[model samples]
Target: MAYPYDSLLPQVTRPRTISPLPPSAPGEEAKDEEVEQVKWKRPAVVTPQAVHSKRALLEKEQEQTASSEMPRPSQGELFPAREQEEQHRQQVEEPEENGQNIKAEPQAELPEAQSDIMALKRKNKDDMRRVQEENLNQQRGDQQNQVSERVAATPLMKHPLPSCLLTNKDHVQAELQDSEASNKVREKRLEEEIKIIRDKANRLSQSLQKQVAIKKINLQGLQRKQLTVNEIMIMKRNRSPSVVNYLDSYLLGEELWLVLEYMDGGALSDVISETFLSEEQMAAISRECLRGLDFLHSNHIIHRDVKSDNILLRTDGSVKLADFGLSTQLTPEQNRRCTLAGTPWWMAPEVVTGQPYGPKVDIWSFGIVGIEMVEREPPYCNQSPASAQRLIATVGTPKLRHPKLLSALLRDFLSCCLQKDEEERWSAMELLQHPFVTSAKPASILSQLINSVKKRKKN
Candidate 1:
């Protein structure tokens, strides 16, 4: 069958045929045919140049076959409708010049097929462009995800604090804590020291308050009274440790101010009322009272008002005789006083009976003070002054409420002081030597009792 493009192929010429030889022998004919076939199949002698030419021709043919088989652009891409029409016009015009009249056929299906192929090529180009772009975007997304994972895996790369700086900061914090603790300790110590100093200052103020006291007396009432003058003179003349010292006296208009040593423990009466004393403590007090009475009697002075109220005490337990307003001096010629000038309860029986008495009256009063210490009050304390004076004159001696409770030595000492006969009563000097008085503890021991009373009162 003839194709439409057959005219484009090269023309091949036919080879000449030889006439057959007449009537060859039947066997010889077969031999002659084989020889002819052999001669026809025999290879021709080939030179180097011919061999090279044949090799080059074979390579050329191979190249032509490859080019024909390879894919090519569609006819629509190679030639548009205008180019196809121009080619057709040239074929028609050149046909008579080539000495042959050839008719050109219109290819109706070629253009339609070329158009469909061109449409498919454009679609493929768009699809390939889209695929390339999508692949590139996917690769970029994968690279970004890998970078994020690396960053998350190693946190030290993001924010790092050096070990040296951290250690130094810890050291500084510890030092600050220690310094604050030390400062607190020092502040506490200073507060304690300040408290101690404040206590000492308070104690010194109290001590100063107890050093001196003033007594005010109206001068108009006692200006001409010899008793007041004698009392002041006697106080000034006495210089015993067991006696209160007189400082100075002042005359302010109608008032006379007598400055005297202040006893911080107040009066012995106050001490007995507030608390009970042991026998040893009472003995110590008796010794001090005896010392004062001895001093007074040795000086020829009679303390007619000797009683617990007239006895003063210091915080150190020193006892002294005070309030010498009822005291009088005795001469060798007149050694007795008949005047009734003492507390009824503590008055001597001879004085209350209107008999003459002397310094031994003070010894009798001291014995009553000893009873006051034990019983908290003297005998006949509930009676009136007149009734007590009557009792003292009628009764030979005042008896204790519970005399059996007293020790033998204490009872003997009281007996010596309370003897009805003035000659039988022991003097203050003789009483000082009594076992009850001699066994007395030191005066310093009484400070404990004084301080306890003060603390209890404060509470």
Candidate 2:
């Protein structure tokens, strides 16, 4: 029988890992779409000329969808029937327009097909990227073919950079622009610029070249050296997850393969689907995430990207925060990191604004994840990543609005996690003591959500 968690939890790479990163899933895992052996279809690249054509096709589809789709009875009127229709319309036609297969039959419940929705959406984005890459390759190919033709026909000009052409007291500015047309040592455009500069340099004399050269005494002394994470980073302490087991790592030519334990439980995002988590349920998940955040913060590591997707679960009610691609290992001297990393929807404000941030950024992300647990998606889930970042940076912390609907204590808890001032924001240590977290049931409470998913999958 097909299992629910089985489809969700991806198989992982178990190689002896060379880097200090945790055990990881293999990079080349084929997506769910390709698993069905469907022939990959390539659509014409989206270009400005085709904009009207694409728009008219979309409008025709929307008109047809509206007429055929009957509105289902609103489920308690909390969410509208139109919302479902819009989602359904998008799901059905989005892939077809973007060059992927439409989903089969509708399921009785969202849980049955929820996993595929994300997979298809992700696939659509990947297809667009592929189209762009192909266009880039074709452009580069054409440029390569014309390199010699351009070199013969076009006269050499001064370097494009203004610094190179300035009339300031620089002596090199007096010489004629270099006219070496055959040379292509730099980038295609840059090589042309360099040849122009070189032609000017040749006229100055061999004496100028002699003055510029600082001959090396010995080339034999230079040798390559070994590299390690510790050499580049000042890691205060190293931490590992109890669930994500590290196996082995070895070098395969240019790439290093790391083996990590496979998580059978998939992600917490999967748990959020098809089920509305209660306050108690949110507390349990939040507490576990906070515990992990605390561990990282204490060790002077910042898990810059903290979101539901990055959190992995196991069958035994254990949850581990995964995906350390954006994680930073700060030394004792470093107070904050200025890198604008992490998912835009869940990003802290300071991070979006390019402001230096400390461990508290993770706390902000943790808060957003808590909100995510309540509403299957994070805040601004509907917005594009660029728009989300713009809105978040301009607006102060996002308010849940309609707060009276949720409990007062829970509202206060959100308030604590989402403080605009990083200095004022409650640390994970402090949030652990809140009544919401304090009264939260043990990690065992999560098993209820997991088991329900499994049962539904089994059905």
Candidate 3:
């Protein structure tokens, strides 16, 4: 039978209830009329609680059906829904808390991080500034050191002491004044010492000059005094009043020193050069020279170089024959000397021609000395030595430059001395007896001429 509100209610699927018919007769067909009828259930009343309960019951029944249909999970594999829900909630809540903490932590530490960055920047700036300052200090120190070294190396006069030693101005000024005063004193002392030294040096130079002049005079004297051993022996052997006296002889090292009589009037050549000789003066000189020659010839010693230069005079007018360096002894075995020697102007023709000659060669030179007295120089005085030799060799007799000025007696005497042939030439003994020599005044009168020459030289 159907209910009245069944159409208004939701349809619910339910199992049908049917009463079984009496066991059907074996092999007998069941008739419709014999079957139990299906009973219709009545609809339940609808309420909020009932509806909720029914939905719950339906969900529960669906779960039971699904549970029954699927295989059951093991206990270890099973997770409770409540526990999963709690875990999910905790995960979500933890993320939210961590996100908040992350945001809050950054916000809270922002100022401190900024402060730390500022501190690091400050430290970097401080370090850079310190390094720059150190570099600047080093540069300043180097510059100061360079300046100090320069000051030290420079001269004291160039770089004076700094006056700014004291902070007080007055003190610095006083100290500078004192230093300047001391420097002035020192400079003055040094200048005085220098002046003294200069004066001493000047005196020393003058003394040295005087010593040199004396040495030069001695050297000239020594030059005239130089004598060979043969000459010295000859001199020692023949010490006549007319010949220069050799007082002593000494050998000093390689040089031979002879102390001879000093002739204050100097050589006859000096007198001839200074003044014109009168015939009488010439005669006197000739007589003295002839005497010396005669003495030398008698001793068998030939005075080869017989010139006015070899004739020296004293202040007392004592004439003597000097400089016997060329004198040679004539032995009886070799009575003639063939050596070509003697001054070219006065050289004999035979001597010039390399012919054997004797003491007559001295007479020829004495004749030339006489010519020197008359003419102030011999014939060919202007010619060179070679040219003079050539003229002497070629010319028979040398002509006097002023023949007219000479007396006949003087000319005759000169001709006798200057003969071309050595054999024809008058001997020194014969010449000493000639009127020209015999007529000569005393040798004491020659001092007047010497004094006059000295006066002229002084003027």
Among these predictions, the greatest TM-score belongs to 1
lDDT of 2: 0.65
How do these models rank on lDDT, best leading?
Answer: 1, 3, 2
- Whichever of 1 and 2 has more TM-score, that candidate is 1
Candidate 1, 16-93: lDDT as tens digits: 265767897889986665444323322222234534665588679767877889866545468788667643333222
Q: Which tens-of-lDDT digit does each residue in 204-247 have in candidate 2? A: 32433321111111112222112223311322234465224333
Give TM per candidate.
Answer: 0.53, 0.48, 0.51
State the lDDT of candidate 3 residue by residue for 5-27, as single tens digits.
34433454323445666777655
Q: Give the Å error, residue 455, model 3.
A: 3.5
User: Where is the poorest 10-residue window by lDDT in model 3?
Assistant: 210-219
The positional error of residue 259 in candidate 3, measured at the CA in angstroms, is: 0.7
Superposed Cα deviation of residue 209, candidate 2 (Å)? 68
Candidate 1 clashing pairs, residues 3+ apart or interchain: none
- Whole-model alpha-carbon lDDT for candidate 3: 0.73
